[model samples]
Target: MTNRSTAIPQLSWSDVCGRRLDRHGLSAPVRDGTPADAVAAMCGAHAQVLSAAEVSIGLRVAGATRADVADALWRERSLVKTFGPRGTVHLLPTRELPLWTGALSAIPPSSTTMPADARLTPDQTDEVIAAVAAALADAELTIDELSTEVVARTSPWAADPVVPAFGGRWPRWRQAMHLAAHRGALCFGPNRGRKVTYTSPRRWLPGLQPAPAADALAGLVRRYLHAYGPATPQQFAQWLSAPRRWATELFDSLASELEEVEVDGSPAWVRAGDTEPPPTPPHGVQLLPYFDAYTVGCHPRNRLFPGPAAQRALAGGQAGNFPVLLIDGTVAGVWHQRRSRRSLDVTVEPLTPLTVAERRELDDRVERLGQILEEKPQLTIGTVLVGGHA
Candidate 1:
């Protein structure tokens, strides 16, 4: 049972993006504006489900802690998930994992998208497992040693004319090691010089068999849309590295629970319900890291940022180079943050001049960010020059 009478309002992309930034405790306006909690009341609360190492990488790049990550894992806040989105891992919240993973499963993996070290015929994989089992029967092996032995045994296969010689890239072997570890045939010996060695499966997730494929895929999809929804099937497809056909199937599966809406004139799918959106703030400024899920979370990209600006921001893949500025509810431009001995320098390059109120609001945000950083409260922040205008 779903209702379509309510036309989903044109949510201010800026508002959603800015609030998202501050919710993560990045930056916010100086005035008596809405806090992240209030703004969460305007748009739906976003879940920080991560599937890839990249999601964590993005968070770490932004200075998040393991505690922050633990909060989102295996819960509604985050789904302990995995798949190829941007050819890396993505962590989605538990609630939304099913649909996104399902959509992702629908997409076939190309050679480029598949892990680098994945060269195993079923028989060869079996052989590798058997070899791994035999090797671990008496002693545990570190990833490096295990990988070395695996290469020796699998070298014959790697040399096959039909095979691509992807024996040592660390992808497939890692997958095999995880399987062996999961199978109780291996356990981790004390952390060996920054790497964990495996003993037998009984040593790790004892007695736990891998979940069914359908179950895993469905779970991934559900989490992705739940956390990053109000997105398009295309965006979902892109996020999952899935094909359009499979994405449609997953979307259709959740059709009753999803609503089609336009975000900034582009079609997007948002969770369906009467749940109130996050509240609006009088003024706002947020410093979002590069590849911040909040920034790349959208499919079309322009819904929250101007296309030109977003593209320019992504021109560089690194995070420290591009710090995003959210003013009001839209991306005003980029802010660059630098660290000094006792203070941090934040420089803003606004796409447009700030109004007197906006500037003051920005100053307050700078103060708050400094407090959070435990650095000097001084901003040392200024706007960038564009066409001789600051």
Candidate 2:
């Protein structure tokens, strides 16, 4: 989406970092907002590890703790856990679930999840989805419980062990689990003991369904642009794990509402009326958890993950594999944490030397992290040998 009629306004990389850090509540993270508001600001929190997702949201708000994020998900019912972007578990603002479901519904289905030989037929997939909805309408159920309910509701073939899992075979109907979540048939419920549970969304928000596709997609584009603008369609596509061509066409359709601009020479687009960069560049040290949305969603990877960060902060150029130490809105190092009964031990591997002031900032970040996690924190600056933070 370009307005090539006149000279395109140019934005510097530093300017982009400054604005993004400010919008993400990281530049001056001492702000006021609920956990759900923080989640909305970041589009959503990648929650494959629920604890990391809680910390991701908690860090964005002033004085917000993991408990606050948990309350929003379980008590207040203001945020929901479901299969979000890329069909990964995420904590999305409950109020925006309809928009998420709508846009996702409009997306063409991606590659199949299971092997071709073991995959369910189209009709069987539909039957499983319907059974899932019907079974979850009133009570929350674990995967095993839901499997039993689904098998009873559908054909016996639905329970056949076809899709291989953690050494064992998963029921054929289980292949449609993410599909059920994406279609708003169900969402994560409070854990029942050590097992996870799923329940229908209708229980909390009656009559909720996907919004009309066209309007919902437009709204989603605007929301995404608001959170991560001055981005390319390819970057947006990569973030959503959607096909590049679909993202390109979506950007083309919203041309009137977007403005193309030059960023360190490369072309990018922002919401039409928003072209000015933040007055101040990003500064200070902040620690980000695994799968933090900012690290996973930002574009122009070379700049966000530069030099040593390219090797330390990312896994083969893919962001979010390692928890990172962000200095001035860019990845600067990698970190690891170990929690005990009384305190959390944190080790940081800095790619760049830290100044006296930066060291103080790092200590402050560790203190705040301890507060959010409800543990005393001990910071160690040395080699971080973790192969996986998750």
Candidate 3:
């Protein structure tokens, strides 16, 4: 079929997000019995789900140790290349660097929270480039090793003791790597002691020249629609942090390719042709990570959490970084757990007064969340109802 004829489905933001993660190869399992594709599929029918986790809760999820978790996230992107998308750092896959960095080169850098004293001058940036090039001519090193090279190469007058600890000089070094990335001089390498290593990109992908800038941007637009389809250009622009002109240009380029849909009475664009519908999630409670893609990717928030309850649960958008209680599809409230002498104490604030059945069901769900976290959850239900913070 040229276009999907089914009615636009009422997918809870959480369910839609979960689907995205599964399709984009961002979910925990690295391989799901499929042969390893050269670089895992970064652009897929459900790309938003991956970016949601990568940008918010981070890419690594189910490893037994923190190091393993961090390593899994690190493989998504070298720390430097990760910052290009959304102009915010993301745990991107190493194989997909070109998709993001290529887009970064087209957008202007916006204001961000990089340490001020760490800023570098143009000449100093050049020095960093020379230093790192010398260090990695044939060698692959972790961020620490690369930082040492940068500190040593910096002039003694420019030296600051805090440079090592605070990376006062590291931004310049990071900039050099970005330059190297742009020139295809740096790329993903084998992991060294838990950190994803980087060597010359040219060396890593010898024949894989990047597509032209216009084509690359177009690819990003297409990928976003496929992954997080039924979205607005405004949403796409915010996700990429692109200028309005560039955003419009990219969308215009794909005029013939996308399909229009009315979601909740708002205009959206979904991919032109995916015949199979996404599977429905089993009804249950889900403890979403703070800043879970489900909450952050969509707009008008009401569709997911209902009313002021969303605001209370979010606590000034701070909720993105913490664990939350998902009752059915919407965020019914917020929850946090603390481990004690023998069990896990989970504090729950329900957005609305729950019926006896709902409370019991929620308790059971919290128990499952505790199981995932490897602890027995002792739930403490809050006295306050919806729209009030605990």
| Candidate that scores best on lDDT | 2
Off by over 4 Å in 3: 1-84, 87-89, 111-148, 151-212, 274-283, 315-319, 340-343, 355-368, 383-390
lDDT of 1 by residue, 1-390 (tens): 224688655654544444344444334322332222221211112222221222223222244333434444422233232322544433433333333333333345434444334455556656676667667665667866776666676655533333233563343544444344323244344446777565543232234344455665555555455555556676767654457776777677766777766556656666676223456552455555444555555444554566656654544432222456766545567766565896867777777777888788778666645644556645544554322101
Candidate 3: tens digits of C-alpha lDDT, residues 286-382: 5554455444554445655677556666665433544456655466777666667758787887777877877887776566555445567788887
Q: Candidates' lDDT values, in order?
A: 0.49, 0.88, 0.53
Off by over 4 Å in 1: 1-84, 89-107, 111-143, 152-211, 274-277, 281-283, 316-321, 340-343, 360-378, 382-390
Question: Which of 1 and 3 is the better model by lDDT?
Answer: 3
Name the lDDT of candidate 1: 0.49
Ten residues in sequence with the least summed lDDT for candidate 3:
31-40
User: Which of the two, 2 or 3, has more TM-score?
Assistant: 2
Model 2 over residues 1-390: C-alpha lDDT tens digits? 787776888999888888888888888764768888888889999999887897798788999989888889888999999999988899999898888888877777777667786888889988999999999999999988999999999999998899888989988888888888877898998899999999997775688898888888889888888888889898888988888999999999999988899998999998886888898878989899999998999888889999878877777778888999999988899898999897899999999899999999999999989999989999999999888543
Would you list the rank order by TM-score, best first? Answer: 2, 3, 1
RMSD (Å) of each candidate, 1 decimal: 8.3, 1.4, 7.2
lDDT of 1 at 169: 38
Per-residue lDDT of 248 in model 3: 64
